[model samples]
Target: MNEIKKVLITEEQLKARNAELGRQITEDFKGKDLLAICILRGSYIFFSDLTREIELPLEVAFMHAASYFDGTESSGKVNLPDQNMLSVEGKDVLLVEDIVDSGRTLAALKATLLKKGVNSLHIVTLLDKPDRRVVDIDVDYSGFVVPDEFVVGYGLDYDQRFRNLKYVGILKEEVYQ
Candidate 1:
């Protein structure tokens, strides 16, 4: 049975931070052709809330990418089964992701998008676990810097469960073992 070990970020904190990020993005990308690409399965919740808070007019798209294969840690290899098919030529692209852990997934996705001749490519993630980063990557906006722990909730999951939780929390060690 899976159990929450600790609440890392509360729902209240998420709401406040998301609002701030929205305002910042709106200000930063104002008057630009903004195209927000949400890396799905984990980022949908954050993308939905964050995009709604952006005051500027923008377009949204979903790209299903995965590096984790039903486990707590990444498989090192990133896969984008659903390729980004939108026309990104000369458009400022913002990749919204739920977490930036190993950074492999984001790096691969960024490389792929860059080939599409985007005007600019930026990354925004709800959580960042810098200690686990195998590839160096910088995020334009980050909601929280978490420790090296297995987290689940607020769209993050373990074996595709616990995503519906309102707050972000660490999963019990026993759950993933």
Candidate 2:
């Protein structure tokens, strides 16, 4: 059996932090029509809790993107998910993602949305890895800034697994060994 190395953000902690993020968002968008655009597969969990915590009227849209295909390297090309059909012509849009590892995905997506005619655009990533950032991307809101270790759970993944784990953890070496 593989022993879990350590747990970073437990489920309870995640809930608390998520609520805090939602409160900040609620306060910010109190008088505006906000669009919560979640990047699929990863940010879905974060997105769901985040949107629910907000007390204001909000619309949501989802998009799937893949900058990392295998191992720990980014493909540098993003396959945008199909749920980007929400009208952002003049709406305040917040691009929500699970993690920003290399900053490539968020950077590309942000530029793409800007070109799509969003009235205002901002980014909020649940986790950030600035040490591995390849581009100078800045997230407007970040839940945590983590080291460059491969993390799983709380929406992050490993070979598309472990996403359901309630806490975020650095996979034990034996798991990879």
Give the winner by lDDT.
1
Assess candidate 1 and give its lDDT: 0.92
Give me the candidate number with maximum TM-score. Answer: 1
Off by more than 4 A, model 2: 1-3, 81-84
lDDT of 2 by residue, 140-170 (tens): 8888888877788978777888888888888
TM-scores, in order shown? 0.97, 0.92
User: What C-alpha lDDT do the candidate models reach, one value each?
Assistant: 0.92, 0.82
List runs of model 1 lying over 4 Å from the truth.
none
Instruction: Give RMSD to native, each candidate.
Output: 1.2, 1.7
